[model samples]
Target chain A: MSRHLLALRQATIGDASESIAAVLDQLAREDPVGAQWLRSLDWAELRRLAAERALAQAAKTLACPLQKQYANASQYGTESGDPPKGTCIGVLVGGDTGYGSSVQLGVAIDGQALSFFWNVASQEAASGTLERMRETVRQAFREQTRILMLELLSEDGEVQREQDAAGRTVLRATLVVGGGAR
Target chain B: MTTKGTITIIAIPKSAEVEVHIDLPEVPECTRIAARMQAVLACLGAPLEDIQDLPAPRQRQGVSHAMRKRVRGGT
Candidate 1:
């Protein structure tokens, strides 16, 4: 997998309100810690924060899975055949809450498979937890693959609950792959 | 808006590569910047599959606070 960082600066001169809000939104998404603190402040304080420094909301995309897999295919009998059955993609969504003080992390998939995993943490300064975030991402991928419609080998469908709220636990649903149209 | 201070970094595992994206100026542009990163990923063989628009999160105010306000009758 290859990773790259793309950053752009956006500054709105005349009406600082719109520009400030936009920057705060991006910051909340990128830096949850900083966002948490920002959330507690009133508009005046928020504007002050905006005026102090330009917001930098950075996000990363994990890619290039196939190219990396082609080499190890010999071991898995993945040679010269059906051209990689599926695509395994992963992403990490994070940001500051509009309040500009709290940070939130959400991880989900593309299809009907909607899995939003989030955690609210303090703004120990505007930043993301790299290691923790990566681990969750890997888990998401694993969950997606196991639940793939066709990958079921036995009657082993399980719903794992990571957290519970109001007597309801957040479910990590798996995709069932591999039945060839059944 | 400028992205000077913030640095966007992508870490590729297999080839052990790291791509850096820097935003110039003071403020950062979110959408356009995201698009540029998508372009870089497209080149690195990670084209976006499809964009799924999820519902926005709704803010939840405390019910107890609302109840208290109702009882006080605009105190």
Candidate 2:
């Protein structure tokens, strides 16, 4: 019998302003062309851009077979007939505490989902947290997941404010084995 | 019969609160998967021992019986 796996990846931003700024700084250094547009964006625009970028990065890591321009949900695997029995991986970000933000990421094999989270209160902390989450994604791919789905969400607060707020972000995943009934 | 499993990992970066859950069918096929998960957690520097175990689901019949007895002997 063939085995199947699925994994989910996610992240949560407690203070969008700080998180956006941090992401923008990184982008400015990494992608000069994109940085130009990012540099001119206001706080509100930057927040939107950052969220989109995060989801895109997650999708890329999953190697989603069907690529879509929208940020939020994406599916990978087979389209027709019985999907091959294999593994799946997912990443998520969530848990936004007032002091900082928390990010969660992981993979699911068969019906099992394994996830990890990181909380950062300061920009410095966020930098490290992002790197670790990225590394976790790399590791999940090495483990071999056939299908991946990524979801992202942000809480409501002062959009332009720089202060951190209390909130929570959850990253969840589900898997099915043997390509059985879903 | 089909076997299934689930695992969840939660981490708090500030206070460093981390929680992991693993749910699998009570069968041998899951052994290798579990071991691989443990290895992944190790590579991530997450302690395997710290993962909290989820309580087994209560029997539906037992719950119903308890509810019936409680209703008959209303407090």
True contacts kept of each: 0.00, 0.08
A1-182 per-residue lDDT for model 2 (tens digits): 22111222233221112243454455455444434543453533222333334444555664432122111222222132211221223334532343222333323222222222222223334346556555534333322211111111011111111122443222333323333311
lDDT of 1 by residue, B23-42 (tens): 22212232333333332222
The digit string of per-residue lDDT tens for model 1 on A23-118 reads 446556765443444344353322222211111111223221211111212322223211122211222334344332122233222221222223
C-alpha local distance difference test of each model: 0.27, 0.31
TM-score of structure candidate 2: 0.25
What TM-score did chain B of candidate 2 earn? Answer: 0.39
User: Least accurate stretch of 10 residues (summed lDDT) in model 2 chain B?
Assistant: B66-75
iRMSD for every model: 21.3, 16.5
CAPRI tier for the interface of model 1: incorrect
